[model samples]
Target: MKQTRTVRQSIVVSAVLLSVLFFLPLAVIEPFRAELFGRETPVEESEPEVGKLDGEVMLQVLNGDMVEEMNLGTYLMGVVRSEMPASFEEEALKAQAVAARTYTLYKIETGGNHGDTADICTDSTCCQAWISEQSARENWGDQADTYAEKIETAVRDTDGQVILYDGAPILAVFHSSSAGLTRASGQVWLNDLPYLQAVDSPEPEDAIPNYYSRAEFSAEEFKSRVMQAYPEADLTGEISTWIQNPVTDEAGSVETVTIGGITMKGSQVRTILGLRSACFEWETEGNTLIFYVTGYGHGVGLSQYGANEMAKEGADWLEIVTHYYTGVTVGPYTPAALQAP
Candidate 1:
């Protein structure tokens, strides 16, 4: 069979373009102080001094009770080295960095951070989990880790204080996907009718699991999601009832809400979980809820999947981030004030 060579050729060309156009140029930027070869470049003396944490920065850092740092160089390199087009533009990369930074600050200040939140696996019921691609691990792992470390170190040096709710450091997780399918953070005073919004909604297109949109949910898809959830149920009408009302073995209260005039039985007493949103759709295939979920993980903050997609399409980090978070800025922080009080 003749494999289509178009995509292969395009990828090769992109790789060549990146090395030649971007990576090769870094050696010439005097202010950056990066080495062309294996040589070390001293941090520039004229580089802006790290600043003291102010009310805004401290609030931003502590509000969510979490903080993260990414070395701009490493972060930029990851986006620059991808199959992005020459037209991807440096400005877009800068924009993405700003948006991501702004969003991070927003979450920290508003939701009080998410420290000690169980890993997606243990907390499966609370949030979803998706695997990073093997290529991402091999190709981008070290760079991404370095970027994260840079950000962390910067924050620490800046004496940035993280706000803790109930004495917890809060939680900070990174991603390349869309904001969740709900409103898990932030606030608005609308005509004095202030209320927290649901923090859930459609998973951003970019955050689909490893480009897993290759599969669509049909009757067959429904069967697969159901089987994954309930292994032994026969796909029959009797089972449909069970699927409709997934009762746990542990005794719990029962309450009902009418959806489209249909009263559905579920756990009584309403509850609000983090970043309210629903991605998986389970249909009744005889007796199982045939779940057809789109995207993966909590649909909040940066969408790593979307980032990957944009990177593939030659978008820089800035472009990817701005597309998700509506309005924000990417600024620098310093270690002046966050010293131990």
Candidate 2:
């Protein structure tokens, strides 16, 4: 009986010792195992919030003395129709849509220059040119349906796409035509933009409407206009001497003209004389100042005629945009992060 009890006790002690031996190593190795093979902390994933402007935008459109609210896409269609000829290539129209959209977004984010109470104005001189769809259709006449379809397709094709510079929407200014080349932003607006650099636009000069325009003014008329703007001018000189030292850019835009002893920028002269473009050459022929002008706009940024020409050459909308806007990327639109104080 004593032997049996001793054997039983020994068996219980061995079992406990074995159990401890097994569990001791496991306990010691568990902590080191985590270090040897990194245990990643479980990260809880939250759902991504939807982006702003979810394919819809609000626009404050100017209608005479009243401001009207319109859908962004609808507004863009009207802008495209009014801004570019409906007869332009589809790719050109698409390019215009993206440009207009980018411009609109930029204006919205940066607080448009029009007014604090209004998002944008219909006045082409103040903001972008906008026209009603009914007016655009009237302009199209027999081709209204076809042209409207094309414009709608272009706008739909490039939906939600914008030209981005450093991840922000570009100003995306466009003009009717260029003087064989696009103007740098600095040359026109005095604000240098990387994407608005001078680029060779292979648009056929003949293809552009009113590519070469001559605006002739009598010497008296020229002097009268100049004097009206710059009242303090010494016009006591030869007619040839009245206009002196005309500085021109590589694109042939007049940078400055010494008129009535006042050095005025080409833009100033263009505005003063109601000229189509700043790219002009003037010479005194008898009592008349014959001004030979080329192109038909401020000559900065994209050229609508040039874009159409590119489209004719098999370049897509993206290619056309990148070509006009140097070093720019066409991508999905994203609202810029607000800068902290």
Candidate 3:
């Protein structure tokens, strides 16, 4: 593919246009916690910082009910181990480490919504996923040593480095896979960010055990489910007409889907139906309503599988992240403040 084959410049990065073009009137299924109907921010671009940092940072991380004081280095090890598969390419893993670091700092600066208990949380549903070295070892079994070294190297190689937009840490959100293209943050959330725009995420279409999946619902069951979320929806007529016009965005994912006289975001429908991704198509087969979904996760930021493909094709970590994150710069950063004391 053009994205993987391009000779990426080392220091600067630009979004790959092909990745942002239409893939499907596509979608996300991300581990995001932001409010969908909240206030939106205007999209803006800024110059990212370019420099190096000298010392490690510290953080107070929420691990269940307890908050533990941890160093950036230690926390990132657990995160890379838990969040990404150990078998991914080394450059891909390194990109994940940097993204995790930038996200941590972003959370800290934003006064994370975890009350006042910690700087960040370990819950993958709300924040990033993390696992201790011991648990990682037991899980990896015989390959434990090899995986441990790889994870450590991924973290160490990118220490203090981050992807920045406008001289601060970018949100740095990422997801597992995309439907040939990633989403712009504005399309999925309340804000449109220049660094988080839609881009080509050309990972292998059949790259996994569940890249494509199906969910089937009988007409009665479907009506019941839709009514549960929207009691006002009129799903009484022909099942086919119930899911009316779907308008797609520039990214190729549906922007709005009119279901049973009620219009909602494709993401809202995806949540109600428990689909793998927001990029989906629905069909009626007699009494059954079947949804065909493509990709996994929110389809924003870096596509983990896409990055791995780039790395496999010899693209470095910098190229991997920059391609997915629009126009961003990679550099070392010293936190405005470490984690909350």
Best by TM-score: 3
Q: Which ten residues in a row have the lowest lDDT in candidate 3?
A: 46-55
Weakest 10 consecutive residues of candidate 1 by summed lDDT: 267-276
Q: Write the per-residue lDDT of candidate 2 for residues 1-341, one digit (tens) a residue.
A: 99999999999999999999999988987877857678755689532121234235666777567888765676787788889999999999999998998898788778787565677777778778888767887988999889978987887778778899998889899999988888888877768999999888876788788888999988778888988999998787678788889899888899888988899889889999989999999888887889999999988788999999999999999999999999988877745432111
Q: Estimate each model's TM-score.
A: 0.34, 0.80, 0.81
Worst ten in a row by lDDT for model 2 = 46-55
* Alpha-carbon runs more than 4 Å astray in model 1: 1-277, 333-336, 339-341
Q: Can you give the lDDT of residue 103 in candidate 1?
A: 30
Summarize candidate 1's per-residue lDDT along 316-335 as a digit string, tens digits: 55454435443432234322
Provide the overall lDDT of each model, using Cα atoms, as 2-decimal numbers: 0.35, 0.83, 0.82
Ranking by TM-score: 3, 2, 1
Q: How many clashes show up per model?
A: 60, 0, 11
lDDT per residue (tens digit) for residues 1-341 in model 3: 56655646421334445444443223341223234535445578532221123134767789998899877888888899999999899999999999998998888878786867888889998889999888999999999989988988888778788889988889999988888888888777778999998888766876665988899999998999899999999988788888988887654566688998998987778788887778888899998999888888878899899899999899999999899887889887776566334
